[model samples]
Target: MTSAVLHSLGAARPYAGSRPLVLERIPVPAPRAGELLVKIERASLCHSDLSVVDGSRVRPLPMALGHEASGTVAAVGPGVPDVKDGDRVVMVFVPGCGDCRACDAGRPALCHRGAAANGSGDLLHGEAVLRTVDGERINHHLGVSAFSDYAVVARESAVVVDNDVPFDIAAMFGCAALTGIGAVLNSAKVSGGESVIVFGLGAVGLMAVMGAAQVAGTTVIAIDPLPEKQALAARCGARAAGAPADAEALVAEHAGDGVDVAIEAVGSARVMESCLGLLTRGGALVSVGLPHPDQVLSVQALQFAGMGKRLLGSYMGDANPARDIPAYLQMWRDGRLPVELLHTDTRPLAEINEGLDALADGRVVRRLFTLAP
Candidate 1:
């Protein structure tokens, strides 16, 4: 019976606004059927984690909350043939069952079983693998619980990556990179010469800028409430970056015809509505953010119909991990995606609360957490 001790930061009372995440020692169990034991190298802090922690999104309490992470396979369970020990990988929150209709149609992001498991806070088998030192059960958040030094995940949740990819950069692919570029390439299918505007200059929004840059002859504009983030957006190769009013003015300059595409990365319904106004006739608007239940996206029926505008709800950027991850990483390797532009530094895992605070306050675009080995 071999086992390892690992420390994790998780909120015992999320949304209660009490203590954030408790650093608790937990046992890393041997990988079971079709599972892998991953030694997490870098786990990035995402707004999704914040949503869960701040109670804006209801999740099982005492949950080891994290879905974005990069790690090396420490061990593989029976029936898992593709991934072996020492292989570098990125964790995907959505795992596609090959037999599912969604997977057969090449849209694994909508896999029914995977979504169910994530919603239930368990592995694919509908059980939790995490346990406290005293033997108390800990809920696995999104089948990852990557806030810990080690995590056991279903094999279907991992995408094996090249050895040369940095852990921090790979970690971003778990959500940020995939969702951002996926919105452009997959959901919007944005092509060359298409004018694009991105709202909310967070990691995902900035990545949308990078993705738009890959399209030839496309004019990319970025919008954000924060001036610092607007500047960051400019650095990411956006031709223009500023407030929502500025985006409106730019749209007006196009003769009241909006850009070819408008991407909404912020979950705010207000922001989502504002994006619709920035679209030209027949333009496509892609929303990748998770919206609050009470929040709604409303549009005037006649205006929407008259303009022939298209509204797309994109979850996880609608990217298939097996195919999209490598292609996005290739862009990262070619200096097109430019991982460094999104992540400027790393924070120790112990300082996770401060990182989350910075994120909540919009002090940082992306926070990379370096887990202790």
Candidate 2:
């Protein structure tokens, strides 16, 4: 089958503000041993994609621009036992090396060499899979370049799911949904009756709100500058929604002392500080946003030392895709995690620029690219 791959031309920075995504037809990839050739059904636009396109995040030029996606197994390479042709799967951001120190320690999210291996555009054998129109080499982004019609991914990176879930929503589970839900359930381990404050009410934040709501006696406080996002947060069971300016007041009104857990989904240093400030004594502050390298946090050392505050950095929400993806799907089936309401809009792959514009304008919460089946 022929495939149409989205290539990042050196022409212009697509994500700097808004620019067209360059699409080019390329040969379908052949899966190697321990690899899966997935025919992508849908790919979701992530904030990280925006950052990469706009040049805020540095990456190899002429790279494919998607990390979150869902698809069906078109073919499987040798020695792959768990997946077969026609199986539905969600691609995971981190391709864990099962024998790595982090993986051995039960922290696959922190796999040491995984990021470098995936980000360097080199395949497992130190080669590049994507090629240009002239047969020149191109780079792959985040291992699973599902922006293309098909992806050649490591077997470990594809999380097989039940055929019941819609491909569009499953695509979201690949990243935003997984990260948010995992942050609450795995990273924070939020228990019933806990009060949680989530800063930023985008797709990730909204999912955090949903995860928090699933636990009995949990109170969800959502913070967002946009009113539409706040409304969505309320729909997802936020006890109250407020802007950063009203964070302290909202905390006081909802929780007598302060929140038990505070999450920073927005990547601004200011927002992180605000989230830290909202936490009660000995409360946990989880940082989920990917701030720029130069971004620095200015915190009062005395407050952290005296109050025993804990700061935790979350990557992919501390997710172990093999375990977490199915659990989230089960939650969706049980109606505990409302995946339907999280989808704010859908567009064709060709209309990705418009969809991204809607995201930037705050017109939608989670916009998906419905690829041709």
Candidate 3:
């Protein structure tokens, strides 16, 4: 199996020149207990993956990079009772053990064991299934590591999906669609007739726009510095889309007293503060983007009480893969959620470095890598 492995971090821009990610043919291990061996069909580049490449999110060296993906179950290990061979599955980055406090409370994103494994670049069971020709270990990225042709993932990380779903569309369900839509429907619970302002118009942010648009009478406002992305957001159901400088004017024109829900997907404390300012009294601000470790948000202490405002941190959109992925796919099938629009194009796995360059340059929304056999 050939996998995209990140050997070093903080590589110079134009990743094509730096060549931070290397393609290596490695051995695929058999799935162990509570694990499944997946034949990856499609994998997509995400800002999170770029973060690791650019040294923003540090991880162990020689790590296989990929999370958002869809694959077919080639084989299942012992204790994996539900999933079977030939089943199509969407890979979830956070693999909930189903026994943790957070999982018991229906919050898989907050699973302590999953977080620890991700931080350590191991799978849910604290194991790395990848190895080089010389036998050096390669860390798994968020338990999935779907950048390769095949991957061994914890059973908790694979959610069975209908086989008919296109692998490309199903791949997005693993991350962007799940997080973005979940933010609107589950985290913020934006209802009909409400107004929503989304900061940043990446795949996740744009999906937020799409989700908000699905509700009756909801007004969606999308903000992005890139004109192309803003245009894409408009097409994704944002009633109005523009640059950050024009956000206030758009809000004033479309939403009289600010929006009911303000979603921050830019991962910037500055942008999060701005989101808070765009919310109506008693409105909620959902922070879906992950900020840097040192970044801190400053706000007036009295606003929560005086204006009845609420600030929330949403990880993976508070999604439960077993429940939400199928529902999102169904919405896609019904034409209510046009997730296909999020795809910019597709490329081969060998061109991953070039793809990262496009992603870093904001040239595309979501570029997928076809890995099917």
Candidate 4:
């Protein structure tokens, strides 16, 4: 398999910085029990991947860096049922261990021991599947590591999709699309006629716009610093798009009171605070952005008490990939959700860094890398 591996860590920077993403050839990974070997066709570049590449998040070095992707099943491990070779699939970032406590409670996103399972860089019993030319160990990020031309992911992580859905669109669903749309529908549960304000008009934010728009009579307000992003936000069904300087005014204008739901998709402390302030009484604030470890979100107790505002953190859009991925694809098919607009560009795996750079510079909304022709 050919993969872009991060071999070292340097200053924490965005993709536009000088850190190089190395492309190398290695042996294709084989599936273990309860795993699936997938031949990746399209892998989407996500802001999270950019964070990992920039060293904002702590990931093992010499790691294959990607989590959003769609591919075809090349092989299936023992005990995996129904799915077979040549089946179209999208990879899930969170591969829940079915018997874990969180899974039993129907919250696999918070599964105990699951993080250890995915983050340990080894399979079930401390076995590494990917190695470098010098026989050095290569860690797997998230569970999928779909940045490679091929990947071995747990069967639980591979969501089978309809044949009609294009691979590029399917790949975006693995992360950005799912995270944004799911955050609105699953996490915040924005209802019909509710007013929603989504901060940061990236792929995730745009998906949130589409999700809110799907709700009958819902008013969508999009906030972004860039005019291009604001324009794209309007196209994604936002009732109005405005700068951060105009967020409060925009919310008041649309909602008449304040927004019923405020979603913060950018990983900035200031934006989070702004989202919180934009919410009406008893409104919910859902945060989808993963801020740096050292950064803290400061909220005043008195303000929350007076405003009756609730703040919640969402991961992977509070998504249950097994259920949500298929539903989202169906919504896309029905034209209720516009998945095509979320994708801005596609490149080869060798240009992964450049893709990330485009994302960092806001040159692209959602960029996917075609791992194979």
Candidate 5:
């Protein structure tokens, strides 16, 4: 038996939006049917987690808040045959039933069953395995709360991988790398020699740059407020634009009309609108960031219609995790995706609050929370 101390969201609203998560020794329950008990190796702090902590995105109280991670299967539940104890895996936030309308159409990323489960903060089976020592139920976040020493996740929610793949890289692939790169290749279907621009140089934004590198002859332009991030984006195969004004200038300089594809990784309505403006006539704008629930975005209706432009929303980069996870890992192995460039720091799970603080200030590209045996 392993001792598991799970971090639970304790406050309805964090005191002044700081120190929101409370750590406790929650019961590490065994996986139920069609589930797996994973000993989390590393959990990457996500922007969505930040939103939840800051009270911007509200979920059930006392939920164990983490979704993106890499882990080793400690146990497998009945009916799960493909994986067993000691298997390494990277988790996926959404799980498809394989029978949903979206899944039937080969778009498992937007499966209604998974979306409904995430919305209600429940497992696909409508039960949470985690519990407090006092027998209180602890809500699981997106079916995989990796902030704990262990998490019980549906068998379909994670992909087993070779042990040689670094755990940190696998942890980020679950979210940042997958979503960012997926936006370019999967959502936008950016082709060879296409011009692309990404707004915001966060981890996901940088991943878009890395993803664009895969398409031969693709040109990547990056826009961000932070000079350091712009510099980083340049290193990741993008032409740096220090601000939106500079981005427009770069767009004209690189692509005579405008970029063939523009991506908005910044979760602001203003940024989304600006991305639409960055696209050339008949070009596509892919919005990957999760904006505020109440935020309403608008574009030039007549202009967009006349230009034959498309505004697309990419959830999880329109990724089919079962197919894309292996493809991304193989791409990394083949030396095409330079995901390691975004890695900044790794701290113990105890330092998650500090990690979130850095994320809040935009100080770190990506931080992985390591779990000790």
Candidate 6:
């Protein structure tokens, strides 16, 4: 099997010149115990992947470069008897070890074991299944390197989906849909008749708009620098959408003093700081963005007590893939959530670097990478 492996980091863009990701035919080991060998059908380019390309978020180098994807289970490893070969599954970046303290508390996204493995670029069980032709080990990205033709993932990382769903649509449930929608439905817990604003109208941010709309009577506002993105946000579900310059005014108009909940999806410390200012006195700010580790966010210590506001960090939308993926699929089926509105374009696996350029340029919301079987 071949995979797009990142041998070096911090390549300057146009990416056409730097070419950080190298496509090479690598060897794939068979599924280990409690794992699955997935034949990836669709993968999506996310800002998280770009963070790695640009060296904003550091990780082990010479690693396979994708995580958000959907595929069919080619084979299921021993001890994962609940799943079977031929099952259609969406691969989650974090593979929860069911016995971990976080998993036991129903917060699988915070599973300590999973975090340790992902940080080391190994699968949940601490194994690297990919290697270069010269035998150099290629680290897995968050356990699901869906950029390759095939991926070996922990059984806990995959949530089975119905075969009827389109591969591209099913793929969305893995990351963008899961994190964005889950952030609204689970983390912030926005209710009907409340006002909500989302910062950064990228795939995750736009999905946040759609999630807020799903709640009846919610006044939704979207903020982005791009006018086209603002327009798309209106179509997605935002009652009002505009650039950052007009954000405070828009919030005052649509949400009165402030919004009940504000979601920061841009991963910008600056934008996150702005989200805090736009919230209502008792409102909460749910930050789902993955900023660089070294970047720091400053907030007045008195604000939490003075204004009764809460700042919460959300990872993977605090999603339990097993529970949320199916529910989200049903929401898509019922027509309440038009997730299809998020898809901007599609590219082949070979065009991944180019896709990253598009994502960074703000030319797309969600770009799918269709892979050959």
Better of 1 and 3 by TM-score: 3
Tens-place lDDT digits, model 3, residues 1-373: 8999999999998899999999889998889988999999999999999999888798888899999999999999998789989999999999998899999999998898999898887888657878898888999999988899999999999899888898989999999988999999999998989999999888999999999999999999999999999988888898999999999999999999788999999989999888888888999999998787789989887779999999988899999988998888888999999888898898889899999999888898899998643
What is the C-alpha local distance difference test score of each model? 0.82, 0.81, 0.91, 0.83, 0.84, 0.89
Return the TM-score for candidate 3, rounded to 2 decimals. Answer: 0.97
Instruction: Tell me the lDDT of model 2 at 174.
Output: 83
Give, for candidate 5, the lowest lDDT window spanning 10 residues: 1-10
Which runs in model 6 stand beyond 4 Å of their true positions?
none
What TM-score does structure 1 among the candidates reach? 0.93
Q: Write the per-residue lDDT of candidate 2 for residues 264-362, one digit (tens) a residue.
A: 898788888877778899888899987776899999977688998889888999998888888888888888877788787777777777666667666
Q: Pairs clashing in candidate 6? A: none
Question: In model 4, which regions exceed 4 Å deviation?
Answer: 11-19, 123-127
Candidate 3 weakest ten by summed lDDT? 121-130
TM-score of each: 0.93, 0.94, 0.97, 0.95, 0.95, 0.98
Off by over 4 Å in 2: 1-20, 124-126
lDDT for residue 65 in candidate 6, whole number 0-100: 92
lDDT of 4 by residue, 195-236 (tens): 999998888999999989999999999999999889888888
Q: Taking the tens digit of each residue's C-alpha lDDT, what string does model 1 give over 1-373?
A: 1122122334443222444776676677777999999988888888998887666677765688778999999999999988989999999989887768887888998888888888877898558888777888778788888877888999988999999999988999989988898899899999988899998888989988988889998889898889988888877888888898788887666425779899998888888788887788899889887777789767776656898889898888898999999998888788787778788578777777667778878888788887773
**lDDT-sorted candidate list, best first:** 3, 6, 5, 4, 1, 2
Better of 2 and 4 by lDDT: 4
Candidate 6 lDDT over residue span 1-373, tens digit each: 7688898888998997778888888877789999999999989999989998899888998889999999999998888988998999999988899898999999999999999999899988757878877878899999999899899999988999999999889988899988999899889999999999999988898888999999999999999999999999998889999889999999989989999999999887888888889888989999999888887889776769999999988899999999999998998999977778888877888888888888889998889987673
